[model samples]
Each structure stands twice: as C-alpha cells, then as structure tokens.
Target: MTAAEAAADLAGGIIRPLFRSGLLVEAKGDASPVTEADRAAERALRAFLTERFPTHGIMGEEYGTERGDAEYLWVLDPIDGTRAFLTGRPLFGTLIGLLHKGQPVLGLIDQPVTRERWIGVAGQPTRFTSPMGGTAACRPCASLATAELSCTSPDIFDAAGTARFDRVRQAARRVTWGGDCYAYGLIALGLVDAVVEGTLKPWDWAALVPVIEGAGGRMTDWQGQALTLHSKGEVIAVGDAALLPEIVSLLS
Candidate 1:
C-alpha cells in the first residue's frame, strides 16, 4: 500500500496541476503523444520507487526499463492516456503494478484529478477511494448480447483485427471509446461489463489483471489464457466469469 499511496500522491502533486494547462505535446517515434506532465510524473514515480525499493526493477512508459535481477519488478505508466490528457479529457489514469516473479501481485489505477483510486492486492478484493469511498466489484452479466463493451478506439486495430473486433463489438449491447486504463477501473466498479483492446504493452495491461481479478472479473489474452509480462498484448476482460468463453470465441 505504501507504493500505491506514493503513486497516487505523485500523480496529485506532479500531474494534476499540468492538466489542461496547455502543456506542450511531443510525438515519440511511434507517434504517441508525450507531454511534460507525462515525463515529470514518470520521473517522480521512478525516483520514489528507486529510493524506496532500490533492489526492485523499474519499467516505465517514458523511461525504459531499469534492468534489475530482483524477484520483484515495478511497472509504471505514469499517464496511461496521453491522448486523453492532450485533449483535456479526464479519462486517463496513472497505472502502477508490482510484479512478483513475473506475476502482478499489487496494482493501482489512480485518476488524480478526480481523486479516485482503485487498489488491487493479490488474493484480496480491490479497494476503492473516490469522493465516496468503497470497495470495487464487478457486477455479473453473463450474456454478451446484453453486455456493455468498451475499447480505446477502433483505429488501433488492423484490417484483420478490425474484422475480429467488429464481431465482438456487434455482439455487445453498446460500445464506448477512449477510456484507456479508466475503462478497466470502471469494470472493477461494475460500471462496465467488458473491455477489449488490441496491441497494448506490458505497462498498459499488466496492472489491470489484479484489478479485474480482485473485482470478481476475468482478464486474459485474446485466446483466454492468463496474462503475463510477456503476453501478445491483445486483452479481453469480462465482468462475469461465465462470459469469458463466449468473448474469447468471438475475439479468436
């Protein structure tokens, strides 16, 4: 909980002030936006993790990995939604996950501006702290036809991937776009039924596994296998565990 608290505090201290302040946005080689806020937030997180847990490795979105041979590793995506941040939308989140022997043991998703946080500790229920504090749990919705589906956007998919995603989208009751890591948080809160995304990174989806799982939901790769630090990046999450087979079938 110390690391999660530090992450939330760092987001509030370094990130919140930069929101909608017209921070300059630059493009990485992959054309993803990187603002000053993103860099600063990540730097602070990296610093804290290094100082507090010097032996653990650190992997971040802005700064690359800090190669360590420890049994534990810290993953950070200081700003999970740079596009949303650039557009002045509040759909972004700060993602922090601790991998113990390559499995996420603790994870957190914090929306600093909203002052909302969800912490997922392994083998325990996900805890939430919003303006109104409570725990997080996924509500059951076994039928795909009645599920509310969410994805970052349709443009992230390729021609073949798009065709597959279209099938999943069509199977759902409704689809919403542009929620980055916040969608998974919503799923944990029982506000969203399922979330499907293509081409995510380790830092992108690793933190979500424990959050989803702790909330009584299921998260996995498109093939429905468990997610690891080395998964192929295609992710599917369904609130109702029974819906997994059907969702995987559609995605596959």
Candidate 2:
C-alpha cells in the first residue's frame, strides 16, 4: 500500500472508534467545531509521516505547519466534515495530499465508514477502490443546465459569494447541500457533476485537485485560474471541462 493509503487507514482507525461516542467538542478560534478524534487522528498521521518521509514537510488542519519550505510537502485533513462524523453520518472523509514544488501532484480521499478510497496522481488516471464497486471515470456533463451541482453548505459563503453560488444553483438541474470531500470523491466516481465552494483553506482543497482532474474533470478557482497554494479559495470543480466557461461567466 502507498503511504497515503496507510495514513488514511491510521487516521480512520483512530476516528472510527470515536464516532458518535459523545466526546467533548471544542470550538477553535475560528469557531469551527473540533473533537479529540480530530486531534488524535492528526497526531498519529503526523507521527507516521515524520517517520516515513523524514525530509518532507507537513501541514495539517489540526496542527500547525512543519518544514514549511521543503520542496515536497504533505497536506492533511484528518476529518474533513467534523459535523458529519459527530452525528454518525458516514459521508465525512480523511484527505491526504502531496505537493511538489508548490503544486499538488498527488491526492487521496478516503471515506472510512464506507471503505471507499479515491487516489489521484499527476499525469495518471484517477484510481478508485471500494467493496461496493464503481468506476473512476467522470460521466459526461454537457452544460450547467443539465448538471448536478453540489456545495458543502451555503453558510460557508459570504453575502456576495452566496449570490454568485445562487446564480449557479438556479441554473443547475439539481443541487446538494453537504458532502464536503466525499462529494468530490463522488465526482471521481461519476456520481456528482460539479462542486462550487468558497472560503476554503489549503488543507480543505489541496487533496481534491488531482482526484477530480485525473478522473476527466477540472478544478479551478471561480475566475478559472488553476488552483495553487496561493489561491483565494473560490473553487469550481466540474466533471466536464466544458462547463467551466459557463460556470465562470455565471460566477462573474
């Protein structure tokens, strides 16, 4: 197994036992909910990465950055949807990503409860493994009017962002409210057509890039620029690259 896969397993093991166990929930400075599971899982992942990739840098949602200037860096979100996990919803996932020279070259999204994993590497087809069975190819989506659009939540957007999102929602044939990283995996699985979201941090999006792109999709900022470590976090991902021009126009 790859190190990313191992990291997902390690984090998932810590997380599964704590699911809906009524652990004390705390509020981070940003007011986001966090639990002991998130902290413990991240610590374990960090320890494993530090041992296995001694020279690579690490950036995690629960912990601060280390070796920030290293050419190769690992980005992790031990639990992408804390609310979903706290409520025993299985849609939450663990995200692991690797960046080389500031570009995301590898990404993995693992939904532990479902035992589904999506792995994407630069210049290669996205790979998916699940006992449930599915292909990793993106289904063709010709236009926004026929697309199934998804976003984690409307609450994450500001007034202006919400207005922009509403424009697309109005055009889409369907809209789903929450899935976080799991929804992105669905795009790789040919389930979801697109996801438009804003106010995301690096760890939140770093792992989604390769998965969508490698599966015959495209992920970029609302302005249509390629996503990078320095991106402003307005992400627009579509199963069909053809949808980008219309999506960008609507966002503008």
Candidate 3:
C-alpha cells in the first residue's frame, strides 16, 4: 500500500494539471499516444520508488524495465486512459501496482480530476473514495443476463479478440466502451458488472486484480486462469464470480 500510495501521489499531482491543457501528443513505435503528462508522471513515480524502495524493480508504460532481478517490482501506468484524457473526459486513471516475486499483491486506481480512488490490497476489501468523500462498494449482480459490461474500446482488440469480446457483450444485458482503467474501478464500485479486455500489459491489469477481487468480485484471464505477471493479458473482471464459466466459454 505504501509503495502504490507514493507512486499515486507523485503521478496524480503531476497529471491533474495536464488534463485538458492541449498538450502535444506523440505516438510511440506501437502507434499509441503519449504526452508530456505521461512522461512526467511516470518519471515522478519511478524516482520515488527508486528512493524509497531501492531494492525493488520498476516497469512503466513510459519508461522501460529496471532492476528486473529484484524480488519485488513496481508496475505503473501514470495515465491509463490517454485517449479519454486527451479528450478531457476525466475517465483516465493512474494505475499503480506491486508485484512480489511476480505476483500482484497491491493495486490502486486514481482519477485525479474527480479525486476518486480505489485501493485494492491482497487480503482486504477494496477501499474507495467518491467525489463527495464517502465509502463505496460494488452492488450484487446475480447473473450475466442482467450484467453491464465495459471495454476501453473494441478497436484495441485484434480481429479474433474482438469477435470473442463481442460474444460476451451480446451475452451481457448491456455494453459500454472507451473507459480504460476506469472501467475496472467502476466494476469495483458496483456501477459496472464486468470488463473484458485484451492485449493488456502487466502495468495495465496487474493492479486491477486485487481491486476487483477485494471488492467481492473476481478477476482472471479470459481462460479463467489466475493472472500472473506473465499472463497473456486477456482479462475478465466480473462482480459475480459465477459468471466466469459462461463468460469464459463465450470468449474461448
């Protein structure tokens, strides 16, 4: 928790001001959009983790890996929903996660613009803050037929993956798009029922596991396997654990 808090503090502080600043965005080699906000926030996070946990490793979206030999590593995404951030949607999130020996044990999702946060610890219920400064929890969803689903965008997925996700979306009662990391937090808050996403990295989904599970939900790969630091990144977050088998079948 301490590790993620520090990173979130530094990154959130740097990112909030840049939200709708018309900052120039540059594309990475993968054609993904990046901005000064992403770079600056990640830099702040890496610096704090280096100073506070020198023995730990670090991997971030803007910065590459460091100290991979360490037993613990910090995975970060200073801004998880850059597309939304660019459009001034306030739907972007700052993600921070801790992996002990390659297993994610802690995670946080912070939306600085609204001052909303969801902290997920390995063995504890998720903690949340709303704009009004009060507690929040996920409501129960008895079945997928009444479930609401989300994805950052169907466009992020490849042809095969999109088809699989479409099946799940059709199975669910409703679907919404373009939320990124905020969608996972919504699931934790019981505002959304499930989130199925593909082609994610460790920094993208690692922190999400604890938050979803701790909120009386479940998170795993689409195959229904546990997510490790090395998982293939086809993720499924569902408030109702019983939906897994049927959802996985659709995705499969």
Name the candidate, 1 or 3, with the larger lDDT value: 1
Q: Which model scores highest in TM-score?
A: 2
**Ten-residue segment with the worst summed lDDT in candidate 3?**
130-139
| Candidate that beats the other on TM-score, 1 or 3, i.e. the better one | 1
lDDT of 2 by residue, 143-245 (tens): 9889999999999999999999999999999999899999999998888999999999889999999999999999999999999888899999999999999
Position 234, candidate 3: lDDT: 90
Candidate 1 vs candidate 2, TM-score winner: 2
Give per-residue CA lDDT, model 3, range 1-252, as digits (tens): 866776787888899888889798898998889999999999999999899999999999888899976899889899998888998998989999888888878999999999899999999989997767655467788677999999888787899998888888888899998789999988888889999988899999988888988988989998999998778889999888988888999988
Q: What C-alpha lDDT does candidate 2 achieve relative to the native structure?
A: 0.92
Task: For candidate 1, write residues 30-118 as lDDT tens digits.
Answer: 89999998889889998888899888999989998896456888888999988998888999999999899988899999998889998
lDDT of each: 0.89, 0.92, 0.88
TM-score of 3: 0.96
lDDT winner among the candidates?
2
Per-candidate alpha-carbon RMSD to the true structure = 1.1, 0.9, 1.2
Candidate ranking under TM-score, highest first, comes to 2, 1, 3
